[model samples]
Target: MRALIAAAIGLAAALAVVLTVTAIGAPPGETSPKPLRTTVPEHP
Candidate 1:
């Protein structure tokens, strides 16, 4: 039970990080299903 809870917490944290970075650092037009692995560009 403890292991399961730890795994869940880890997964949640990882998901939160991904979402935070995507929402904050990603560009404005990443709604499609192709560019899920985009990198931060140099400038606008």
Candidate 2:
């Protein structure tokens, strides 16, 4: 019974660490902007 409880606690801790790391490693919004399109002229 004690072992089971310990294992659950360890699993929860691992999940929390993974989530925190992933959140921190993600890039912030608006870091990369989209390019604008330009019209091209036709040649005769």
Q: Lowest-lDDT window of 10 residues in candidate 2?
A: 28-37
> How would you encode candidate 2's per-residue C-alpha lDDT over 1-44 as one tens digit per residue?
99999999999999999999998897766654876658776879
- CA lDDT for candidate 1: 0.87
Residue 6's lDDT in candidate 1? 100
The residue-by-residue lDDT of candidate 1 on 1-44, one tens digit each, is 99999999999999999999988886667467766648877886
Please list the Cα RMSD from the true structure of every candidate, rounded to 1 decimal place.
10.8, 10.0
lDDT of 2: 0.88
Q: After superposition, how far is residue 30 of candidate 2 from its true place, in Å?
A: 20
Highest lDDT, which number? 2
Looking at model 1, residue 39 earns an lDDT score of 81
- TM-score per candidate: 0.56, 0.55
